[model samples]
Target: MRYEPISNELFIQNRKNFMAQMKPNSVAAFNSNDIYPIGADSTIPFQQDRNIYYLSGVDQEDSILVLFPDAPKPEHREILFLKETNPHIAVWEGEKIDEEKALQIAGIKTVYWLKDFHKIFHELMSQSETIYINTNEHYRAAHDTETREDRFNKWLKENYPAHQVAKSNPILQRLRSVKHQLELDTMQTACNITEKAFRRILKETKPNIWEFELEAEIMHEFLKNRSRGFAYTPIIASGKNATVLHYIENKHQCKDGDLILFDVGAEYANYASDMSRTIPVNGKFTDRQKQIYNAVNRVKKEATKMLVPGTLWAEYHVEVGKLMTSELLDLKLLDKADVQNEDPKWPAYKKYFMHGTSHHIGLDTHDYGLLHEPIKANQVFTVEPGIYLPEEHIGVRLEDDVVIQENGEPFNLMRNIPIEIEEIEDLMNQ
Candidate 1:
């Protein structure tokens, strides 16, 4: 791993919290993600499963974590099964985690190779009455590929027909939603890395520069800071391209007087930071551009203040719609009649601001959290609100990752990143 080692206490406490919610005599298991294959002998880069990484801090493939909190043998309560490493294998690939290193990383005393998994699992399963199986239940998930966890779940259900099965997704969704101090610190590092990239772009950007060149600059900053790359595919949309929400074809040269919408972030230690900023190509926003940019910035500020505890995700967006509606009316995008006669199902504000105002942001860009439930403190979210005017070839979005505090306003993780029009203009010119 390029990132520094995380303290095992985080994993230890995470496991303790998860176990506290488990049914008695239940055995829960988590598997690492598969190294998916492309065509020919090549395979995609390995990404560790978030659940296993959360519980064990083991960021390797072919790893499994079995938590049997009520195991008959005390040492068997928390076990880690890792891929066997021999000297020859170590020469082929870099050294894999040995038993001692696994213990140090995961804070679990018991470790075994993958070869011993079936035999030990059978014994453990016989002693337990229920099994907690991990599943991908995040709201935004739409994958068709079967993951390693899915395959393991299938085999477990087929072989152990009598065992009572429970879903680990619900428990994990709630547990992982709130930020731990260490996790918040790690996310801050990612945001700081992203801030560096944004500042680098501010100085490097000029009229006639190709969008791909700007992308390269951001990648350079991220790699120098020990980040693998973007948490998600970056959207470097310029001019009318900014109105297209997911535009990623960064091929055109940024023309003078056009605004570029940058939806990008860096990842550190598998934690994610999401940010969106719209800046001018020629280092200065036009009069109309400044007007729209400041409108989005004001909406972002007010929306962030609404992220306090007890706010419902659904209701919060509704309130943000009202804020955006007010801005749209002021900008002449909507008149009084447009607001009065608008359908409640899809308000007049939807014409200018289409997407949701915010989403949970952490390990994943859209991190796991129950939107139906009331908001709570220590929950980190992205406050992103935008207005896209295709006719004027203008789109403006300002976003920041914030942590909902126990009292008063939420804390901004990207507070240091320049957002004010004057600050951005000064930096770009300087």
Candidate 2:
């Protein structure tokens, strides 16, 4: 792990909260993500499954966490199974986590090697009446590749068909939607690293600079700050490229008198920070660009204010649309006739701003939160508003990650990052 160690208490509390929601006599299992193979003898970098890492703080491959709160033996209540570290593995792949280290890292007293997993899990299944299986149920999930967890689920049903099954996704969706203090602190670190990268880019950006060059500068800053890299695929769109919402080719050279849109964030310790900012390549926005930029910034501010407790996600978006419509009217992009004739399902503002204004952000760029439920305190969200004009070859988006407060306004995690036109222009010209 390049990032500093996270406090084990976060994992402890997360496990406690999740177990509390489990049905009586239930055992839950979480599996580590597989190290996907690209070709012969080579594999993609391993990433621990977020669900297992959330409960155990164990970041490794071929690891498993099983929670059996109703187990007859006290040690079986919480168990961690890790890949056995032998002398050969030590020499070739470095030392894997041992028993004592797992205790310190995950607060689990009973640690077993992978070889004992089949016998032990069978014993656990014989004793437990129900099993909770972790599954990906995020609103945007579209998984085609089978995962280690999926394979384990299939094996579990085949071997132990008598055990009643339940989904862990619902419980996790509600629990993980609310952030713990330690999680918030780690996300703040991620945002701080992203700020450094953005500041560095502001200084390096100029006309004829390739978008990939700016991306390289971002990676340089992230690596120095102990972040693995961008939380999601970064979008470094310049000029008309910015109009594409998911532009990531990053091959175009920035042109003078054109604006560049950056939808990028750095990840520290697996916690994600999502940020978006658009600025002129020439270090100053033209009058037309300023009009669109200020309009988007205004919408972002208003939308963030609505992310308070008890605010429904669907209704909040409708209110944000009204705000954007007013801004579009002020910018002369839409007239009274356009507003009256627009479809209610797809408002007039959708022409310029086609995407949602906000989404939950945490371990995943589009993290988990039940959209139908009302917003809550400690829940983090990204407030991003944009106006894209492909004909004008201009695109402007301004985004910030904010935490909903128990009262008053939400706390902006990216407050230190430069978003104001004057601040960005001054830093770029300096």
**Worst 10-residue lDDT window, candidate 1:** 97-106
Candidate 2 lDDT by residue in tens digits, 1-430: 7888888899999999999999999999999999999999999878889999989999999999999998999999999999999999999998798888887888889999999999999899989999999999998999899999999999999988999999999999988889999999999999999999999999999999999999999999999999999898999999999999999899999999999999999988889999999989989999999999999988998899889999999999999999999999999999999999999999999999999999999888899899999999999999999999999999999999999999999999999999988999999999
Over 119-141, each residue of candidate 1 has an lDDT whose tens digit, in order, gives 99999999999999999999899
Steric clash pairs (candidate 1): none
User: Which regions of candidate 1 fall more than 4 Å away from where they truly are?
Assistant: none
**After superposition, candidate 2 runs with Cα above 4 Å error:** none
Residue 314 deviation, candidate 1, in Å? 0.8
Pairs clashing in candidate 2? none
Report the CA-based lDDT of candidate 2 relative to the real structure.
0.94
Candidate 1 overall lDDT versus native: 0.94
Go through the candidates in order and give each one's C-alpha lDDT. Answer: 0.94, 0.94
Query: How high is the lDDT of residue 29 in model 1?
Result: 97
